[model samples]
Target: MDVDLVVPGLYCLRPEFGQAYLWLDGRSATLVDTGIVGSGPAITALLTELDADLDRIVITHGHQDHAGSAAELRAATGAPVLAHAGDAAAIRGERPMPPPVLLDWERPLFDSIASNVPPNPPCPVDQEIAEGDVLDFGGGARVLSIPGHTDGSVAIHLPRSEVLFAGDTIANVDELMLGVFNVDRAKAIESFRRLAELGTEIACFGHGDPLIGDAGAKLRAAAAKITG
Candidate 1:
């Protein structure tokens, strides 16, 4: 388990293969993403140690790596689960995501991670979010619907903090890169462009190290290359 406070009140938790984040505001917190199966306990313990209240679990999408432990975490902390309606079914385990259209290089990495992910059971979604929805937590995070990584993929932007929790819509794997294994490539690119326009100072990605300081410039450059 890799646990570190990326910002004053934002902590990143990496367990085995995927990442989850804990966002703190005063005494309350919101958990973004839930790593592979069996990660709830670790997250609960982390919040307890820090004396932060677990207010809710906000899933970026329905991918198992992101929503796998939502049920468990909700049970542990009594936090509601929020997700985009387009991905609610998958998050609830009603259906499987479409097969990803991978580049040659992406396949190996995908396989390596997928093979280790345990089967995820159905999880409940207490709220369905969409574009322009504002979660009034941690000084209010505005939801930007940056679909393409998945139909309902969303990023949470905190205007007060100038921080963007970019959930797999973009990554920083070598530099800023479009997330691999997207269900819709074109939508993914469009989402990237939308994110580039946000101009945030800090970006937290689902994979790779978080980029602090002028993260928007990096995203804009990447977006321009794709659009041009």
Candidate 2:
């Protein structure tokens, strides 16, 4: 795992398949997402090296790559896992994950990677979060319910810092674009537009490099080109 500093108190943890972020507030830290399974030890080590204790673990959605190590990390650090109620059941293994309605072009890619993706163990969500909830991290991170990547997808916005943790609602894989593999493309597009309007200067995404400056303008530009 590679740790990249996004700012003075923010660090992005890049694992092999996905990314997780660490937000520090003095000696306490909040984890935005937990990368795929087997990422617990690395993350725990990182926290120890930084001398920051994990205060909370927030899941943007119920996807395996995003929430896979949540349970493990929670166990190791004793941090409560919080997730949206809409996806809590799925994350807890009460129900199977809802499959994405793949676009024609996405099918081939999805098929190629699906088998290699490990199944996430059932994780217990200690708190059920929702839109408008302000989490005690990054100077009060506000949760914006941005469904369509999954019914419980969300983006964490920190107005004080002008930063947004856009969890798969938008991606910067090659360039800024809407996230693919969605259950509802239209809803995802709407969510993407909503995030673009936040006007944040910095944006962090789940699958790509963080947008450090003028992120809102870039998002708006990308959003304008996205047609239903």
Candidate 3:
């Protein structure tokens, strides 16, 4: 596991699979997306080093990589877990995750990685969030319901800080591209475009390195090339 500073008060935690972001607000912190299972200890250590208390655990979606350690972390820190209502059941283990509608080219890649991802245990969500809801972190994070990656996928936009936490709607692997493995590709594309319209200076993604400057323009350029 590796932790890197993304901005003044934000840090990105990279584990073996997926990424988790830590946002510091005073002595309290908000964690966005918990890496795959067994990632809890490393994250807890980092928070301890910073002398920060866990304020909340926000799961971008119900995917295992994103919500895997949510239960463990919440249990350890006594922090509330938040997720979109659309995926609440899946996160709570009341239902199965909606399978992605993989494209022909995505088959091999998905098959290769799917087996490596550990199954996420059921986690309880203390808050069910939706579009337009302002979470009390990062100067009020506006929840933009950007579904399609999963029925409940969301992008958290901090208009005050001009930073956007794009869950899996977008990725920056080798470059800025639309995230793959979507249950609804068309809706994901639309959501991508909507996120591009936001005015942001920095964009943190669930994978790859984040765009630190002029992120809005980069997102727009990438969005312009994508078609449903």
Q: Which candidate gets the maximum lDDT versus the true structure?
A: 3
| Winner on lDDT (2 vs 3) | 3
Q: Is candidate 1 or candidate 3 better by lDDT?
A: 3
Model 3 agreement with the true structure over 1-228: per-residue lDDT tens digits:
999998888999999899989999988899999999999999999999999999999999999899999999999999999999999999999999999999999999999989999988999999999999999998899999998999999999999999999999999999888999999999999999999999999999998899999999999999999877
Candidate numbers sorted by lDDT from highest down: 3, 2, 1
> Which residues of candidate 1, in runs, are more than 4 Å off?
none
Clashing pairs in 1: 148-188
**Runs off by more than 4 Å, candidate 2:** none
CA-only RMSD, every prediction: 1.4, 0.7, 0.6
Candidate 3 positional error at 123, Å: 0.5
* Candidate 2 all-Cα RMSD: 0.7
lDDT scores of the candidates, listed in order? 0.86, 0.93, 0.94
Instruction: List TM-scores for all candidates, in order.
Output: 0.95, 0.98, 0.99
Candidate 1 is scored at a TM of 0.95
Worst 10 residues of 3 by lDDT: 3-12
